[model samples]
Each structure stands twice: as C-alpha cells, then as structure tokens.
Target: MSKLFTSYDLSGVMLSNRVVMAPMTRTRTPSNTANELTALYYAQRASAGLLITEGLPISEEGRGYLYTPGLYTDEHTHAWKEVTDAVHAKGGKIFAQLWHVGRMSHVSIQPGNQSPVSSGEVPATNTTVYAWTEDGKEGPVLPSVPRALRTDEVQRVTQDFVSSARRAIEAGFDGVELMAANAFVFDQFLSSSLNTRDDQYGGSIANRQRFMLETIDALAEAIGGERVGVRISPFGRLYDLQAFDGEEETWASVASALNERTLAYVHLNYQPTITAAEVPAGFGAAFRKAYRGTLIGAGGFTRELAEAELEKGDLDLFAFGTSYISNPDLVERMKNGWPLAEPDRSTFYGVIGAKGYTDYPVFDAGNESLKTVA
Candidate 1:
C-alpha cells in the first residue's frame, strides 16, 4: 500500500490515512451557524484521515466574509456538535480552523458597522471581501479601512482565540487548527509592509511574529498542545501582502519557533504552480529541517506529487481542498485510480441547497449505484 493510504499518528490521534480535507469556505451558513446540512457536508467527506473545517470566526469582530460560520456563541457550539458527531460516527477526526480576518473585512460585516481592527491602520487595497454590497445583497466589496489595535487590546484578541478553542472542545472537535495562513489576522501582523505599528507587535520580525506566537502559546495552555495545529503560508502574496525584507528569514524564524512547541503539526500552504518563483529555493526542505514535527503540505497536490514529497520526507500528510469538493470519496478514488469528478464553480459558494455541496456521489467501479450514503 502507498504511504498515503497507511495509518499514522497525528499527535495522539490515530488517523486511518495521511490524506486531509483542507478547509474551503463554502459560505452555506447565512445565519452564521452550522446546521444539519453542514453535518452532512463533512460526513460525506469523512473518508479522509482528518477533516479541517472552513474558517470559523472566533468572534463576530473576527469575521470578514458573509455566510461563514462563527465559533464564539453557545448556539454555535451546539450547532457544530452535530457535524462533529457525524464525522466521528464515520471514524474521522475533525479540527475546527479558528479565524480572525483582521483588516481584511468590510464595515458592514463588523459589529455596529465599526471598522475592522488590525496591527496597523491599513486597508487591503484591490482586494474585496465577500460582504453586503450597496444594494444590500451579498457580493464582493472593498474592505473598509481598519483601525490600529491598541497595544493593550492585542492580548484581548489572543483571549478571543483561547475562548473559541474552548468552545470547539465543547463542540466535540478532536482538535483545532489556527488560521494563521492566507492574509488573516496573524498574517496581517506577520507582513512587514502591512504592519507599521510602533508597539511591541511590529517593526522587527520578532515583534511582528509576537502576536501569533503568543496566541499559539495561549491556545496550547487552554487546550493541550497535542491537539493544536497551525497553518502558515510563507512568501504568500495573497490579499495585497507584499514580499518584504527578511521574508525568508522571517519564515525560517517561524519554523524554528514552532519547533520549540509540542503542537500536532505545521501545515504549510505552498503552491508551486503560483508561488514557485516567489518562494525561496529549497524552502520546503529548509522548513522540514527546521521543524522536525509532523508537517502537512497543501496547495494543488496530486497523489503522485504527494507521494514524491512523502518519499523525500518533506511532508507527513497531504491536504486536498478543491479535489474534495466534487470527490467526497477522494481517497478511495486515488487509491483505486478512478476517474475524478469536476466541481461546478458557480455553485461553489453562497448556495442554499445541497446542489453543489453534499450532492456529490461516490465513485462506483461496478456501476451498480451512484448515490452518496451520507
């Protein structure tokens, strides 16, 4: 059997395989709560060794896009229980990816129509958040200018993450993954060009990375370090983030710092197709060397590519995002070499029903039936 199909231990949790379902925001929850549909969606893809949920805002202020679920309220905890139960029933482990958009948000999405908060007073230029437009309809709109967070208030944000992680445990999640990747709250602070704060949270790379490391430590304290995971994108240019000075050194520092902690794994969102030129040479190998713990690699990975990396000892697990959308039986199909299905882009987000969400059927080699049990 291929290494990808073999069982492996993730911290203390034993997975049946090394394939992970990467979090993809489908925006199905208009009320900002998970429902039976959400349970069904995850349950269908439970074949993956582990399932990382879509970004769940730690607080209302942490939200940036509309229709995404929130993780602060008791009602939110209660709602997610169904999803967790379903995934567990199918013998899968799931992690809630806690998110705070920071400045990548619109005023309409903020509480009391307030501006979004960030490490500095900067707006994500040329980037649009999924929010209410001028006509009161949900669509893409320019992110609102944000206010710089007071130095004292930085701890409050970290507390927010701690609070949410506790709620995730109550919701029966096996673990939690911090959404430190892509241009979210931690990314806002990590980017040298974006964070101009004169406080202890900005200027130098150490200060810029302080907020993220503090939050990670707090989460580890609240929930055991064994149940925590973090996702980061080095040299990531998403959401107007620029390639700044000490870019390589900053990421190397992050890897070195994470090595000191006893976390579940470090998830690297590396895309060779889009970021090969920008990412430093041998970056993956360098990160693997710095962080000796389990490492999961995401971004356009096929079975062949993932196997190659595993052979090289660069990645412990492989994450599939878009592939999981249309192929709930992705692992089985890959293992059996079955043809894969394509997802409908139009029905990718903001959809009300199970048309594009839970309606994907599993592959049947015998051609006897094509219905999805979940």
Candidate 2:
C-alpha cells in the first residue's frame, strides 16, 4: 500500500490518510455564516485525512472580504457546528483557520467605514481588497492606508486570537490553525520592513517575533498546545510585503520557537504570492530540521511530488488547493490513480450558488458525465 493511504496520529487525533484539503476561499457564504451548502460542500470532501477550512475572520475588524465567515458570534459558531457535524458524520477531521487581514482591508469592509489597523501606517501596494459599493455590489477596491496599532491595542488583538480559538473549539473543530502567513496581521508584525514601530513588538528579530510567539502562547493556554497549529510563509513578499535582511535567520528563529512549544504541526505555504516563484530548493529540508514537529507542505503539489517528499521524510502530510476545488474525492482519486478533473477557475471565487460549488462531479467508472451526491 502507498504510504499516502496509511493513517498518522496528529497529537491525539488519528488522520485516516496523509492527504490534506488545503483551505481555499470560495465566497459561497453571502451572510458570513455557514449554511446547508457549506455543510454539504465540506461533507463531500470528508475523505481527506485533514480538511482545513477557508480563512475565517476572528472579529468584524479582521474581515477583509465581503462573504467570508467569522467565529466571534453565536450565529457563526452555531453555523460552523453544522459543518463540523456533517464532516464528523462521515468520519472526517477538520481544523479551522483563523484570520485577520490587518492592513490588507478597505474602509468599505471596516466597521463604520473606519481605516484598517496594522503594525504601522503602511499601505499595501499592488494589491486590492474585495469591497462593496453603495448598492451592495462587490468589486475590487484599493486598500486604505492603515493606522499603526498602539502597544495596548496589540495586546487586545492577541486576546482576540485566543477568543477566536476558543470559539473554534466550541464550533466542534478538532483543532485550530492560526493564519500568520500571506502578509496578514501576524506577518505585518514579523516583517522588519512593515513593522517600523519602536516598541517591544518591533525591532530585532526577537522583538519582531514577540507578537506571534505571544499569540501562540495565548492560544496554547486557551486550547491545548497539542490542538494548535500555525501557518507561515518565511520568504513571502505577497501583498507588497518587502523583504528585509536576515530573511532566512528570521524564519529559522521562528521555527525554533515553535519547536519548543511542541504544537501539532507547522503548515508551510510555498506559494508566497499568486505570482511568486516556487520556494528555493532544499528550504523544506532546512525547515524540517529546525522544527522537530509534524510539517505539512502546501502549494501546487502533485501526487508524485507529495509522495517523494513523504518518502524522504520531509513532509508528514501534503495539502492540495486547486485540485480540491473541483475534485471532492481528491484523496480517493489520488489513491486509486484515477484521472483528476480540471477546476473551473472562473467559478473559483465570488459565486453565490452551487453551480461551481458543490456541483462538481466525482469520478465514475461507468460513465463520463459529472455526478454530484448533493
């Protein structure tokens, strides 16, 4: 049997296989609440050993898009229970990815049309946010220049992450993953170029890493350390994030810190930006050596590439993004050597109905037409 089909223990949770359904934003929830469609969508892909849901805002201020879900309200928690229940019914395990977009947001999405908050008063360049017009039509809008967060406010934001993690547990998630990558709030603090503050949360790599480490400690305190995972993109320059000196050392220090915590896993996204090149060769091996925990790699990984990494012991699990958008039974398809389906890029996001959501066909040996159980 292929190692991909074998089970692995994540902390105390037993994953059925090594294939992970990487979180991809599909903008199907218009009300920012998981509904029947959301439940069915996740249930369809329950075959994956681990399913990381799309990035969910931790609070109203954290929202950067029009229709993404949240975890702060009772409605949000209850709605997510439906999704978790559906996935659990099919014997699947899942983790909620908590997010805060920080400076990457427009006033249109901010509460009371206020400016977004960030580590400093920097405006993200070469990027646009999903904003809404006066008539409630969604369109791309330039993000506003954000105000620097005060020292006290930074502490509050850390607490917000802790509260959101608690809510995720209440919502029935087996675990929770922090969205510290892709130039979001956490990355803003970690970046020397973006974080120009003179406070303790800024300067030297140790000071710059304070916020993330504190946030991780708080999350581990609220939820068990074994149930917390973090995602990072060390060399990421996405959303106009500028690279500074000591880029490699900064990440190495971050990984060493995580190693001390003994968390469930560290998810590394190799695709820093939509247009960025692949990660430098051997970066994963170096990261694995730094962090002696389960390491999951995400990018445009093929079955062959994933198998190679697992065989070499570099990656304990591999996540699929675009493939999971169309192939609901992605793990089974990869395991059985079935021909995979091409995803419809046009309907990948901002779709209100199920045309491209839960309507994708699973592989059928007897026929070629797409078949959907939902």
Candidate 3:
C-alpha cells in the first residue's frame, strides 16, 4: 500500500490518510467573517487527512488584505462555527492558521487608516497588499512604511494570538497553526535583516527567537501544547525579505526550541521560484532530526515525489496547495490515478463568487455533467 494512503496519528488526532490540504487564501470573505460559502468550500475537500484554513488575522491590526477572515470577534467565532461544523460533518479535521501581516500591510487595510506595525520601521519594497478603492474595486497596492512596535506592545500582540487561539477552539477547530512564515509579523521578528530592535525581541539569535518562543508559550498555555503547530519559511525572501548570513543558525535554534515542546508538527514551506536549489540539500532530514516531531512539507510536490519521500521517511505528511484548490477530491484522484485538473491562475485570488471558487469540476472519466458537493 502507498504510504500516503496509510492512516497516521498527528498528536492525538488520527487521520485516515497522509495527504494534507495546504492552506490557500481565497478572498471570498468580504466582511472578514466566514460564512456558508466558506463552509461549503472546506467541506468539499474533507477527504484530505488534514485541512488547514487560510491565514486568518488574529485582530484588526493583523489584517494584511482587504477580504481575509478574522478571529478576534464573537461574530467571527460564530461564523467559523458553521465552517467547522460543515467540515466535521464530513469527518474532516481542520486547523486554523493564525496570521499577523506586520509590515506587509497598507494603511488602507489598517484600522482607522493607521500605519502598519512591524518589528522595525523598515518598509518592504517591491511588494503590495490587497486594497479596496472607494469604488469598491479591489487590487494589489504598494504597502506603506510601518512603525516599529513598541517594546511593551509586543506582549500585547502575543496576547492577541492567545485570544485568537481560544476563539478558534470555540469555533470547533481541531488545532491552531501559527503563521510564522513568509515575512509576516512572526517572520519579521525572526529575520536579522528585518528585526533590528535592541531589546529582548531582537539583536542576538536567542533574542530574535524570543518573540516566537514566547508566543508559542502563550498559545500552548491557552490551548494545549499538543494542539499547536507552527509554519516557517526559513530561506524565504519573498516580500522584499532578504536572506541573511545567520539563516541556518536561526532556524537551527528554532528547531531545537520546538523540540522541547509537545507540539503537533512543524510545517516547512519551500519556495521553488526563490532559488534553483529548492529546500537546499538535506534540509528536511536535518529539521526532522532536530525537531523530533511530525514534519509536513509543502510546495510543488507530485504524487511520485510524495510517495518517495513518505517511503524514505523524509516527510510524515505531504501538503498539496494548488492541486487541492482545483480538485476537492484530490485524495481520491491520487488513489485512483485519475488525471488532475489545472487550477485557473487568473481566478486564484480576489474572486467574489463561485465562478473560480467552488466551481472546479470533479474527475469523471465518463465525462458526465460536473457537480459540486454542496
């Protein structure tokens, strides 16, 4: 039997298979609240062993895009209840990915049109954020320079994460994954190039990691440590975030730190476009050795490659991003060797309706009329 189809235990949750649906941002929540459509979208892909929701802002200040969902309000928690109920009805386990955009945000999305907050006062160049104009049209716009977070305010942000995690539990999520990757708030603190603060939150490797580790501590205290997972992009340079000389040492410290926690998993996101050497050689194995917990790898992974990695024990689970977006029955397709459908890149983001959202056709060799689960 292919290892991908084998059941595995993540923390205490027993998944039916090893295929995880990686989180992808679909900007359908205009009101920053998950609704029936969001529920249907997730329930359609319940076959995945584990399904992670798109990055959800922990607070109004954490919002980076115009239409992403938030978890800081009672209304948001009530709305997400519908989504979690739908996925649970289909026997699926889901996790909420908590996010804080930091300096990657524009004032248009910030509360009261204020400047975005970050570890430092630097601006991310050649990067843009989704913004809505007066005419209600939405598109990418350049982000504004951000003010450095006050040393005392850092703890407040960590409390926001704790509150968000509690809300996620109330909304019926099986777990919560911190968005510490892709040059977001947590990543900003981890990057030596971005975090130039002199306090306990920056400067040395241990100081840079203090915020992340402290956030994890708070999250584990609110929710059990076993129910928390973290995602990190160690070598990512996206959003004008440059690679520094201490990248290896920084990540090693992170891995070693996480090893001490009874966490669920450490998710690694590999950006193929950033460099030809995707994931650098032996990176996965080295991390697995360091963390000693479940490790999930996400990128452009094929079925053959996923199987090989699982067979060799490099990855405990394989996360599919674009493939899951287009094919809701991705696990079945992989099992039956069905041809996969290509996702419509044009409709990948900022779509309002089901045109590019839930309209993807399920595989039908007989070429029958396509139908959505909902």
What lDDT does each candidate get? 0.92, 0.89, 0.88
* Cα RMSD (angstroms) for every candidate in the order listed: 1.1, 1.5, 1.7
Tens digits of per-residue lDDT, candidate 3, 1-374, equal: 78899899999999989999998888888888988889989999998999999999999899989889899999999999999999999999999999999998888878999999999988988888898655667778888899999989999999999999999999999999999988899889988888989999999999999998999999999999889999988787778887776888898899999999988898988646543235577777888889888999887888898998887886798899999888998998899888788889999887877877888877775664455556
lDDT score of residue 181 within candidate 1 = 90
As for candidate 3, its clashing pairs are none
| Candidate 3 TM-score over all chains jointly | 0.96
Displacement of the residue 26 alpha carbon in candidate 1, Å: 0.6
Candidate 3, lDDT over the whole model = 0.88
Per-candidate TM equals 0.98, 0.97, 0.96
Question: Could you tell me the TM-score of candidate 2?
Answer: 0.97
Inter-residue clash pairs, candidate 2:
none
Ranking by lDDT: 1, 2, 3
- Backbone clashes in candidate 3 total 0
Model 2, span 38-77: residue lDDT tens = 9999999999999999999999899988889888899999
Q: How many collisions per candidate?
A: 0, 0, 0
Off by over 4 Å in 1: 273-277
lDDT of 2 at 144: 89
Over all chains combined, what TM-score does candidate 1 have?
0.98
